[model samples]
Structure formats: C-alpha cells, structure tokens
Target: MPVAYNDDMDKRLIQLGAAVIDTEAHAIAALRTRINGNFAAACKYMLACEGRIVILGMGKSGHIGGKIAATLASTGTPAFFVHPGEASHGDLGMITEKDVVLALSNSGETEEICTILPLIKRLGVPLIALTGQPRSTLGKVADIHIDISVEKEACPLGLAPTASSTATLAMGDALAIALLESRGFTAEDFARSHPGGRLGRRLLLRISDIMHKGEEIPAIPENVLLSSALLEMTRKGLGMTAVVNAQNHAVGIFTDGDLRRALDQGIDVHITPIAKIMTANCKTLGPDLLAAEALQIMQRHRINALLVVDTEQRLIGALNMHDLLRAGVL
Candidate 1:
C-alpha cells in the first residue's frame, strides 16, 4: 500500500513537470511572432550606441536580465545589468546619452523600473522595454517595446514567474543572436571576449603559435644516409625528419614507420640514402593554419607529426602531437 501511494505521488510530480515545460514551450512559440521590425529597430539602436547597453529588472526578471546582458556582451554587444532598485540611488550614473537602456517587467509597472524612467529619459538615452503589458507604464514610455506577454503562468496557482520568465529569456536570446549575426560576429570575435575558455583556445590558436621552428626543426639533406636521418629524428624526438634538397626545400619525409617498413624490405639503414626510402610529397602544413586544423590533418592521416612549410615548400617548422597537447589545442 505504501509503495502504491508513493508511485502515485511520483506520477503526479512528473505530470506537473511536464505541464510546466509544455506551457513554457507554448509561450515561446507565441512570442516568436513579436520578433518583427520593432525587434530589428532595438538591435539597430544597440549596434549604433557608442556606449554600453544597460539592462534593468527586478526579482526573477533581474536574474534573466543579468544572463541577457552577459550573452550580449560576450557576443559582440557591450552590455551590463543594473538592478532597477540600485539605479534609483547612484547606479543611475552609469547611463549616458551614448548608452541604451533595456528594462524588463512583466507588469511593466514595477516601481523600481518606472521610478528611474524620467532620469534615463532626461539623459536622452534610448529606452527599450520587455514587458508583458504593452499598455503598462514601461512599454508606453519606451522608444521600443518588446512584448514578453504570456497566456498564463505554468504555476498551478498562475502566480509564479515560470512561463513568463521562460518567454522573456527566449526573447532576450533572440535579440542577442540576431544582433550577433547582423554585426557579422565570427567565432574569433566571440573568442576574444572568452580568452580563458575552451572555445577561445580552439578559435584563436594557430600553428605558428605552437610549432617548433629554427634549430628545433628536424631535417636531413636528401644525400644523408638513412642512419643520419634516424639520428636527426632521434635528436628532435618528433619521430620524423624532413628530407630537404640542395635548396633546403622539403622534397620528402622519413618517419619511424617508414624506417620500420624499410628494414622489413631488407634495406640497410647504413648504406641507403634517406631519399631512397622517404615518402615524397608528404602532407605539410602552413604556419598560419589553425592548430585545430592541424589536429584534424594529423588524425586523418594517422600521423603523429607534421612539417610546416612555406608556399615554396621549404621546411620552416615542425610539430608533434605532444606540442598541440601542451598548447591546449588538443
């Protein structure tokens, strides 16, 4: 009997969770239509603003506002969150004519947000509002109105922020991504804002930043015996040596695997010139190529090392899998 009772309770809890998700999904679908020219105008104003975007809200809206500000700032638009309550004191000084204000309120009559409107207006900063009520105080006074209204809250009591907060967050994401695309923001631009993160490492790392150059490059002349090539590969420990011609241009490559194959073919390492056993036209990379691309090439070729060459095919650098790992490009 106890098990049966607990099972029924679990079922009820699951149903409630599903209801909340469905309600929020519906709310966002409805909000999609509100993304017309008005939304574009707001993005335009933000793009042209020489100063930063100042976001404001209270309670759950405040939390969402902070996330929106972060997304906008990270994606190329500079932005920050100023709690409406704090702004009424001295935080309002953060706003200027060069800036833009984005205020969020479900009812659009939150006293904290409305109380500061006059000051922002006095500063001549453009105002954009995300509110459930277009006729409410915030929407009525804003230069742009983004309707974040919802049919109903997902809360069984229809009081908690659930569905409305989801809609507001979705709207915020819509605005940020649209602005990101309009500004032609690339992964590299986004990486600059997140230099300490993994995406930044992947997007900003180049082969030149990690490759071994100068004396670190392992190479042997085509006339060198296979034993000399093996010694060069051992000294560099990259498991390979570039075979360069009289002009010092890479003509072939000899790796540990190549040596093994040569030995199996009954060739004497002491007597054979490296040119006799080297793989000609081996895959080479340029200095400016992304380290991420280098990783791909190495993986596809099942090789552990690569020779970096110029357009004329002179060996300028060398790198192994370990170098990429140390540089965090792995």
Candidate 2:
C-alpha cells in the first residue's frame, strides 16, 4: 500500500536535492583554479609515457579512477586502471619504467595505494597524484601533485565522497582533453579508437557504403518523359530520380517535391519531358564523402534526396533521407 503524500516533507526533499547539485557544482567550479603548471607537468608526463598509464585508487576514488582511465584511453591516450589492492599481489609488475602512475585519494593516504608507492618508485616511473591533502603521504611522494580539494562534501554528514570525487573526475577529464589537443587528435583519430560506437559510424561511413548503386539507382535520360521518370522512381522507391545526359552525367534531378510543383502548375506528366520538371544542376555528392556530411547537405538545402556522382559528374548512385536513417547515420 502507498503511504499518504507529505507535502512539507516533499518540499524539503526537493530543496535538499537542489542544494546537493549546487554544492557539487561549486566544487567543480573551484577546480578551474587548480589547472596550473603542475597540471601541465602531469599532462607532459602522461604524453611522454610510452606504455599505458596505470591508475590506482581505493573505494570511491577507485571508481572515479576507472572512469578517468577509460576517458584517457578513448582520447588517444593509452591508459588502464589497476586496483591498488590487486597491485600488492603481483599486479605491481604491470607498471613498467615506460608507464606513468596516477593515484587518486581524497585523504591522500589510502592504505592500499601507499603499500605500492615504494614499488612504483623503485620502477622509476613518473608518479602523478590527485589528492585533497597536498601534505599527505601520497601527495608528498608524488613527482607531481594536483590538488582536487573541495570546500565541503554534498553529503549532509560530511563523510561521503561527493564533492571531492566530483572534483577528481573533472581534473581527470581536464588532463585527458589537454593531452588530446596536445597530440593534435582529430575526429577521425577518435573514431579509429571507437569503431563500434555511433561517432565512429558517423566519421567512418562514406556515402558509397550506403547509397543505392547500379540498378538500384533511379536515373532516367534527360529526354525521358515525366511519366517514365515517375515509373522509375516508383520502381526504385527512393522518392527521386536523377536525369542524366547522353554521357550518363547527372544533368538534373527530379524528386517528390518536383512532382508536387509540376502538379500545382497542371503540367501533363505523360507529355512533358522530365527535363521540364527536373531541378537543373541539382546538388550532388561524391561517393567518397561521409554519410554524416551528406545529412548536413540535405538539411542545409532542405532537400530529401541527393545523387552520387564521380569526378566527371557522371551518376554512380543515389540516396535519400531514408537511406541515412536505415544506415544509422541520421
């Protein structure tokens, strides 16, 4: 059974939720000042690292460290997370002289991480630390220390890792993005790392991959009648047909929109040449163009279809908005 609603209690809960967001927001906002020379040095170390960046943390900081590692890996930086506890039991071998170690601890003295500091130092790898306490064991030992302290936690009890964790994650993102820019990483580079994701499809899929080709393309000769063009459009079901010249060059395009305008003008579909109703010099795309870019062209011109042409402007394929939708490029 549902309990009766308490209006005053509900109001108080809503206000508490808003206050928590405000607290976390302020914590992240304060991190802007922490992006200093030390931040630059940390990025430098990671950028120069030949092996994967090994991240270590305990409890909540460990969760944040995992996310930070993932962000770095996807942004053209090689990185992975190793639990501090696991490092004690032979996992410490994973950290090599070519790698850089990044440790996260709000108190700057997580026992699990401290246990491996000597091993990491012995490996002679660069160590960067994210901690609220600059004078703590982890911070004092690190070659580079980044302060991620916050004024207060969003937790009312001041015990949970709320604001501090948020600050650490933001700093991690700052490091990843700074290195990404430093490496001159482009969208194509990012797509290579994320071939299974939506962004990869948008970047890697070309018009040739999805456009209707050969017999699938609805194209008619410029001298064909409007009635024949309509039949071709129906057979192809692409809602459009390209009007080609004697050399199979796309001279114009006839789409559903053109059919509407021709009807509004009371033109004879059976007797009128397709050229009379076709849009001359219609927008055409190269087969090598990206499908995502094709969508942009369609949107900017307010058209639903496009003809694919070769370097000589000869019609090679055709595609419509539906093709993009079906291909997941929309």
**TM-score of every model versus the real structure:** 0.90, 0.93
lDDT of 1 at 155: 91
Off by over 4 Å in 2: 1-6
1-330 per-residue lDDT for model 1 (tens digits): 564535877999888889989999999999878999889999899999999999999999999999999999999899999999999889998888899999999999999999999998999999999999999999999999999999999998999999999999999999999989999999999999998887888888999999999998899999989999989988988889899998889988999899899989999889998888899999898999999999999999899889999999888999989998988888
For model 2, residues 1-330, the per-residue Cα lDDT tens digits are 966556998879888999999999999999998899999999999989999899999999999999999999999999999999999998998888999999999999899999989989999999999999999999999999999999999999999999999999999999999999999999999999988888999999999999999999998999989999999999999999999999999999999999999999999998999988799989998999999999999999999999999999989999999999988888
Model 1: residues with Cα > 4 Å off, grouped in runs: 1-6, 299-302
